[model samples]
Target: MLELGENPDTAYQKIKQLFVHLNLPERLWSLSPTTFSGGEKQRVNIARALSVDYPILLLDEPTSALDETNSKAVIQLLQERQAKGSALIGIFHDEHVKNQLCTRELTFGD
Candidate 1:
């Protein structure tokens, strides 16, 4: 939220949207993320990282903990960010996700 600079309202709205898209209960918004499940915490981490309007994004296995539905939502969000000109650098092992979001592929080592 602090990363949003002067626009907190926008941040709150985005957070709410993320919580919904990630299937997090609205009741948990005020609670500490430590109380969340592994997948829930992962969703929170993803939401927080994406809340900021950064020129560059770095993600490592962003959907590893999520189910197919939630993973698709995250992919959509990342695609929107990409369309808005954020350069995404990610390590995704899921071939479907990789194919959907990566415009260029780089492989190291066999």
Candidate 2:
């Protein structure tokens, strides 16, 4: 949050929004994410990343640990960011998510 030049209050608000969007419980906010479940921790990570404002985003399997609902929410957030002119470079095995978010496709080694 500080790294993004956001004040503490703004960071808190942004994190709170992400937490709500990702369905993370507010109780877990005061604790270390290491103690959370895999999906919970993943939500924390995603929230942290999305909380920052970046021109370009690089994500690897962003929804791998998320369920369908959470995945859809994340996709929606990413789409919103894309609409705002953020460039996303991601590796997603979920073809549906990839197709929804990507305007162009790139393939790697066969």
In order, the Cα lDDT scores of the candidates are 0.88, 0.88
Tell me each candidate's TM-score: 0.90, 0.92
Q: Tens-digit lDDT track for model 2 on 48-93?
A: 7788778999989888988999899889989998998999999988
User: What residue runs in model 1 are displaced by over 4 Å at the alpha carbon?
Assistant: none
State candidate 2's TM-score. Answer: 0.92
Model 2 CA deviation exceeding 4 Å by range: none
- Best-matching candidate per TM-score: 2
Q: Scored by Cα lDDT, where does model 1 land? A: 0.88
Candidate 1 lDDT, 1-110, residue by residue in tens: 75437477777787898889878898899998789888889889888888878899998999999999889888999999999999999998999999988999999889
